[model samples]
Target: MKNMVEIRWHGRGGQGAKTAALLFADSAMSSGKFIQAFPEYGPERMGAPVQSFDRLSDEPITLHCGITSPDIVVILDPTLMATVDTTAGVKDDGVIIINTALSPAQIRKEMGIKGKKIFTIDASGISKSTLGREIPNTPMLGALIKVSKLLDIEKVLDDTKKKLEKKFRTKPELIEGNLKAIKRAYEEVKGE
Candidate 1:
């Protein structure tokens, strides 16, 4: 697991956290990398806090337990920061991508975070304008990919398009909107 990258996602239920992890795993697998994507939650209801995890590596991943320490953290809802320790267990040099309009410096000050790289993006706004909804998961994926540099953006878009098509075939607009959201977030994310 020399090149392994663990990612933890924090978001509320019904906001596509699980879906984003799955899509990320699928995209990595499509690029010939080993990946594991799973969610950790119990009896959850809509708007309840939830967590999802992803492990990507160039070699086989044998561990089958929870991720206590992650190399990257993606926060799909800035509100979760009020209750969840969004930076919990992240490595000292880990990258954090948060869905918010605030600058990374502001988030760092508010959260009292240090050392780790922080990226902020208006994922909700991007999703609302592109997908007609406020689901920030897909846009967060873009931010993660941009920050992690673990996979090619084009390849991810292609793989994600294929996966999304299976379910949104009838609604081409929905599929396109999701793609647009991802690309927009990728470009608009700010880091500090």
Candidate 2:
């Protein structure tokens, strides 16, 4: 696991955290990388806190357990910070990508996070404008890609488009909206 990168996702149920991890795994796999993605749920209800994990590496991954220390953490629901220890187990030099309207510095001050790199994006606003919904997962994925540099943006978008097409067959508009959301978040995320 020398080149391995582990990612932990924090979001609420019905917010597509699981879907985002799956999409990221699919994209990485398409790029010829070894990948694993899975979700851990609490009560399995809307607004319930949920966590998902992803491990990507150039070599095969043998670990089949929970990610205790992740290299990167993606927080789709900023509100979860109030109840969840979102930073728990993250490496000291880890990167944290948060979906919020606040700046990275503001988030760092509010959360009292130090040392680790922090990136922030208004994913909810991006999703609402691009997809006409408040689902922040897809936008968060874009922000993660931008911050992590894990995969090519074009490849992720192409792979994600194919997946979305399968799930939203006749809704070309929905597919395009999601793509737009990803691109917007990719370009709009701010880091410190």
lDDT of each: 0.92, 0.93
Which regions of candidate 1 fall more than 4 Å away from where they truly are? none
Candidate 2 local lDDT, 86-112, one digit each (tens): 999889899999999999999999989
What is the lDDT, from 0 to 100, of the residue 157 in candidate 1? 91
Candidate 2 regions exceeding 4 Å error are none
Candidate 2: Cα lDDT at 113: 84
Clashes of 2: 0
Considering only N, C-alpha and C atoms within 3 Å, which residue pairs clash in candidate 1? none
| Deviation of model 2 at 10, angstroms | 0.3
lDDT of 1 by residue, 1-192 (tens): 699999999989999889999989989999999999999969888999999999999999999999999999999988899898889988999989999999999999998888999999999999999999898989999988899999999999988888889989899999999999999999999997
RMSD of each: 0.9, 0.9
